[model samples]
Target: MPQQPNCFHAFQQDVSAIKLPARFTFPFYYQPHPLAEIAAEQLQQTLLTNNNWQHNFGLNADDDPDSAVGKMFGILVVQDQQGQLGYLSAFSGKVADTNALPGFVPPVFDMLSKDSFFKDDLAIITKVSNEYKQALQQPLYSQLQRQVSEQNQAFDKALAQFKGDASERKAQRKQQRAQAKQTLSEQDYLAFEQQLSQASVIDKLKLRDLKVLWQQRIQATQQSLDSVEAEIQSLAKTRRKLSNRLQKRLFSQYRFLNNLGERKDLNDIFAETPFKVPPAGAGECAAPKLLQYAFEQALAPICMAEFWWGRSPKSEIRRHKHYYPSCYSKCQPILGHMLEGLALDENPLLINPGKDKHLAIVYEDNDMVVVNKPSGLLSVPGKNIDDSVYSRIKRQYPQATGPLIVHRLDMSTSGLMVLALTSRANKALQRQFVERSVNKNYIAEVTGIVEADEGEITLPLTLDIDDRPRQKVCFDTGKPAHTIYKVMQRTATTTRLSMYPKTGRTHQLRVHCAHPQGLNMAIVGDEHYGTKADRLRLHAEYLQIKHPITQKVLSFKVAAEF
Candidate 1:
């Protein structure tokens, strides 16, 4: 095997003279570098040639080669110490229980190394966990649990006996009253009932003594259970405190560096949040590890890419060989701190320019206007983006009044949107929406086949506050959202559906289509709930509403291009 390049000086003079890549690798999102693609192709070819490589990727020869289960491979374009451009590959998580590969860069932290501090910390954690387990298995603890269980059974039996006795006595008293009723007048019967009640008082006194005795037994048993439970709880608390202390110490040891060479420990990274810092290996994702190595080796990072090379996991949707952006839950905050000094490419999706912007006006009247909105355009002006449908329409009809936008489509969803021209029209249209008199239809292509021709989905939804812009099913504190869908077509791997939303909660259609309890499949190209595609495969296809000023029913339909 060829030896890997140690430094830039190790490269040939010709290779060293090549100019650096024009753009720095985007920290969050990126297209693969041409060289990186070549490298990945080479890696794939190499794996095909070597059966051992398949095993390294956790692929069995017997398994289907096209299975979606896969690993994520990242290639970073970098200049060596001699200023020679080359690519270094790394895989997310681990490959075959190892981080070191012949041509790949090493992990930032080697937790697997026997001599590493992480090993010692892990050992301590293991010991603590075993201690907790052993404490539970102790004879005294087992006896206490058994005693609680036995006493509970006894208490139940005693209570049942008391209830049975009471019922029997009441039955006998009722029979006596019935027999006496035949010989007595109504007034006489009432007097006899008083006598029967007086006789029952003695039985009540004896039952009270029995009740007190059982209550005392239950109380004693409960006290014993509480004492044992307290001891068990104390042990758990001690273990947790010890674990946390060790974790804090471990996290403090992991210090990361940005492009500027400024350092921040893992503890510092999570200081503002309510949670304590995660353990030593937190934030050691493929992207961060690659960047850290590049910075340390004085490499100039150019374009980079990360693509899945194995089967997708059960929880998230990841197609084999597809490039995915860094995860927001884990990588966002860390990259925010790490990419401080690098000049980043302008995010094209966020930029909005004035003038020459076209709004496809489908229909317009004195009271309202209907326009077709393209995918990747916002419905209204946001904090950072102002060139939305509302903004464009406002410029076109500057004299228009009230909130022009009557409803919204997600930025990635293309479709027809209706805007009111005046406050009266807006109020009328808003009322129609509130009363669900306005009917809207959306066309979407989802990831799976639809067995059912049509179905109704009702899921309450609320914004995931911690992860902004993403909505989740929240039964406890969510507004009810309903969607009625009909299958329009079905392909081998996808289904096309027409959806009618009863309530216009944000991302209601997307969530309804993606949630397991609902459709159990995601709309194709839905980036938030599904995998990223060229665009979200959803379009607002039709709308029907009563014209506000004219009081005439109006309907509009647009064909979905997809």
Candidate 2:
């Protein structure tokens, strides 16, 4: 391959005049770039004008035209050799004709290409998988399974026969004792019963021998079955090993170039993480593809953005024409290594934008204090954040001891929080929370109008470990979370609600609100589950609890400002 021209010179000339972004976006949480916004608007307009645009983009028409679930799109702003600014567009999976559209960039690797190594390796993988499947359906395999089943049944039948014989012998022994008792004195009858019991022991021992023999026969058949199963498992392992090897080789071939004139393959990019190498198609996401091409072509990266272009999937929450941050599981590791050597922007997410905001004290006492926590403030100190409600309380009361935080609210959710001033208060408040004595009401504005006036949502929730901080609805291994909600008012496209949570789990309300099985509508401005807004439209409205010290029932209310 010929060396590509360096497009960085034109970008460098304008670098001095450009005010770089405070940070490279975390890729998991961000607002779209200005250029991307323009591009998205243009794309939306194009779709409106062209009735056959879906066909052109190679998108399948949704079964329900009223549904908003569709596809994800991405755009990267770049500077050409002439210093002209233009954007590169891409889709999440694939667009029409394998991403061969004119304004859109192609994938890093063409796995769909007939001439590629992926095709050849996939053929071998398919052959092995088919062979394994065929082996399981062979006549010998079927015959062995049937033999095992028949042997098990035979053993069970024999065991039942032995048991029946033992019962009959016991009955005969009892009848002999009764007959002897009718004719003999009381002492003589007792002696006769003892002798009968001794005779019955001999019969029991014979039955035991029969049971052992039957058990041995069953064990022999089971061993045969085990051997067959082991053989089948070995074949499966072989197929899996071949497929894994092919994937590793494919990832190794996806090499990315950085502005430092250094090149590292996807295998090297993820070498340090838990995943030693990038997953399949790790570098094919829109952001990585555009950046890689820019570095190779020497085009300067100005800004980049990714958005969902169509309806959301049934399994996850997404909105039409809404911007979304890049995925962390696939893109983070790749972007972390790819953004090296350029005069890149600082990651704005790393900075605490709400540090200067003070915690508003709603109620205070010697034993405990209630504070109105602002949105964007952490309830407790995080790994990178030290300015939190707990930390602030500690600063206010230097003499206080024990865990101060009795509960927590989401960083994006503004609400009333009560902090304990002493260990006794902490224990008391914690007990109330555990016993479901504390009553809390949250006010929120959801994206869609709610049809019902009041209802309760019971959904099991568990963390999506792969995607940190994001929770998913999982019935099998999840904790139960409950929320009762009443519609306060309905707008044209939104519903304002008052929610009372019965159980607290991470992102409980957010997940419950957006879950298809629950309300099926996301809270407005829920960046993780819904669309981005100026802020999350959720606020703590009211709290009711017993005073830890006085044992007096106290209630506090803070109306939502949204």
Candidate 3:
């Protein structure tokens, strides 16, 4: 604290959030002009008034407006130095009053605007463009559906063929057994063998002993057949999972590409995949997660097909699995196969309320948590019975409290997820994210050959029924999900990329990457977002945050390849 108590009363400012809450606390994260030089008139005077910077603005580092956005010019905020009290903070006017006190700047009010100022431009595409895009979309979506249909047909055909073949083979085996039993009747066998052995000096051992050996061999053969059947059942289960995943991926890829062709703007949505054949060294978990991540990421671009009953939070969640038993009313035969493949989870399934339920968390802290969930994974269990990554993680680590989520990640996009463990920590971390205090980065491989080495993408996203679960890149309906993507590496087969999702959104990265005006390409391997690949190539590369317990800035990075 300054020993001199020669300052006036509290001075302040008012600020507001733009379309998507641009930044919360302005002065804190603002960087200033390099202190290497200052204006001649304000040089010495600036030195003298250096200590008073914190008095006007809430931050204390040497900063200016030249190098960055919130430099020297902003509404001034004032408060008692010793008091640990202050408002949530607001923005002041841009104009400053020079003739006023040394710390006097502009009068301020309201941290956030009472309303948003965006005027959405939801102009439908031209007939020509619309028709062109539809031509591409219909084929792909239709193909995906066909793949599933054909798959079912093939399975049915194979099953029928197998059953017929099994019946024929079983009949043959039954005939052979019967013939062998008849030919080896005890009376005929004993008499014939005795006559033939009369000439041999040493007849074989006793017939009773031989009969016992034959019975043992028959039992062993039956056991062998049982083991073979069990093995076939296990293999069948594995094949079904693989087939289902593949079909899902193919559909996701087509959906992303079809959406891309419909655009007429900045970048084209790409349709190339970015995965190399599975390397020899991929471990079990690594392979599955990678494949899962790719599918999830691709799915991220696709808007959830089912909404309204999609995302539901805890304060508004409920129990599931209702039951209404009636007296003497039962369908015993039908109930026999009811519980076929319902896997048991620790928690009962919960239903979602809106599109927000499946938002993924990409980053987390003591008070907040991030998730990179699936289109199906709820952000938080809708009802007590619903199972989401949020609920699952918290349950896994009971000691950590306050699983408050600050921002949302697309459920399908494989990216950074964050969370806070406590309310205080949540507030602090939220400020950091809101102020653009954290540094985040990602990697996305689109379908096309992007010529740009580095570029910024600015597109607005809005909710559209046509974009079911997918955010349409309309000027008016959506908030800005800015992304700066660079072509990291390219192959004749695929293109690799690095990206940074500037703002968190329901499906920002996928939609942005696939914007027609931009890349005009789908993120390869992103079945939900763009082109479905073996997996979603999008991965959260880095995250920076102020540690809740340490009170120091901390960073976390995940490799794109991993």
Candidate 4:
């Protein structure tokens, strides 16, 4: 590539000695950068004052582990937004070394020595750089070729099986017809007819005349299945081979999940975090693990459907049209919300949450996922050294992913939550909630006396931030909300009430319970919404919804207590 005037750049790295497969020099990068600032004084002046940029490259071991001998030589240096040398990093380049290694020669060799080719011969270096840049796409091209080859193999395999199956069927039809006409005697034919009549289905007929056809078809089907399975296994092997290949060829590194239950290295680093714990007598088959597995399994298909086939708020795809991620600047933890309800590429076997895993699983189906969570746990990863439910779920099932957090429960308020796993279910379930077809109930302990045996708390609520009833009731222009309170039981100091929030609001129950006109009652143990115990004594007791698959009413009941 032709070098730009007054621009020069080189990788700033120095490694005294080298080892294999573990570490690299300069954290070894292969991208280009702007070297104008560090270039000649003229270039530096132009970069800082004029905001001009000149792209460049920094060679590593691929050139020469020590000197500029084997380097992929030449660069087009430039300045970047940060007033630093800038360009696309890790862009591929090449050298004219005849003894170049077959596999990748990592750019671990740093401490660049640029030739200031722009000064020496800008045009020559520019041509060389351009050529090298184009060569970088070779990997992508190779991948495409491999994919096409595999696809062709698969298609041919399938076609061959179909032809064999068809041939067998034709042979069977002819033989069977011939045998029916001439082979079977009258008595034998009568017996055969009787047996055929008794047969539950004509499609399952297995006669000697059709032996070649039936057996051949079976063999062909089995062969086709075996071929598909073999290909699948091979594909997996190829994927596994990639890391090793990349490491051997390019000295690359990445992460993999803890396959056998736990990662020892990770455990050593994070010894404080709890591992998957087994119940005292449950052994390896503990309830938590089983529950988690079953829940994950049920959600696998549904979760996948939402991402692959489900709609998105901005998606132009018809199937993904309804996938609206209720996330925006107004919604705090907005990114977290999107991650759970829109898109999350879970890989590395979903980092299982540790001690603070505060998720209350509400419902699961082939098409949806639901959870009843306490207030403190985040809906996704957030600022307070925490992550939301969406992050954890993605960590478990990396594929078939979507962030359809259909509904959200406040970090503090314990309540039922539902998420659609499939795009279709996402739309249906969302509609169900919007149409007020889903039933939910809560348990709360409120303060003060209650003369009325039962009454409705018609109050709207939003974030009050005020000292009294932080999530307070406002007769003003707050969101419309309502709660039905029935005195479940009462004490001289407190009233255990079953709260049914008719309208979902920020803090309807606590606000209503502590209405100033009423006993000025505050919910027992509600710190934010009221003053009571150490934590809010509220629970999502029961939930009801039509089963996604069966279309039957399914209710989840949890008796409440203070």
Q: Which candidate is the best by TM-score?
A: 2
TM-score to true structure, per model: 0.68, 0.79, 0.35, 0.35
Deviation (Å) of 186 in candidate 2: 16
Candidate 2 per-residue C-alpha lDDT over 1-562 given as tens digits, one digit per residue, 9 for 90 to 100: 3332432212212333444354444456667665556656766665557654343322346345444336677766676676576556667656544644555666777777777898888898898888888879878778878877887788778778877987887888878777887899999988888888887888778778877887787787778777877888888998899888988888877787777878777778788789685655577677887787787776777777777665555446566677777777778887777888665555666777568777889999889999999988989988888989988999998888889999999888998999999999999999999999999999999989899999999888888754577888877888999999999999999999999999988898898898778888999888888877888999988999999988899999998889
Whole-structure CA lDDT of model 4: 0.43
Assess candidate 2 and give its TM-score to the true structure: 0.79
Q: Relative to the true structure, how large is the alpha-carbon lDDT of every model?
A: 0.75, 0.78, 0.42, 0.43
Where model 4 places Cα greater than 4 Å from the true spot, the runs are 1-362, 465-469, 517-519
What tens-digit string does per-residue lDDT give for candidate 3 at 135-224? Answer: 445554455445555655655565566557656655765565566557888776666556444523122233334445545554455455
Candidates 1 and 2 compared by lDDT, better number: 2
Off by over 4 Å in 1: 1-22, 46-61, 64-69, 130-211, 273-276, 279-281, 352-373, 379-383, 386-408, 416-440, 445-537, 543-556
Query: Using alpha carbons, what is the TM-score of model 4?
Result: 0.35
Residue-level error in angstroms, candidate 3, position 560: 2.8
Q: Ten consecutive residues with minimal summed lDDT in candidate 3?
A: 301-310
lDDT of 1 by residue, 101-217 (tens): 655667766667787776777677687678778767778777766776777788678768877987898898899899989889999999999998986887778678867876787
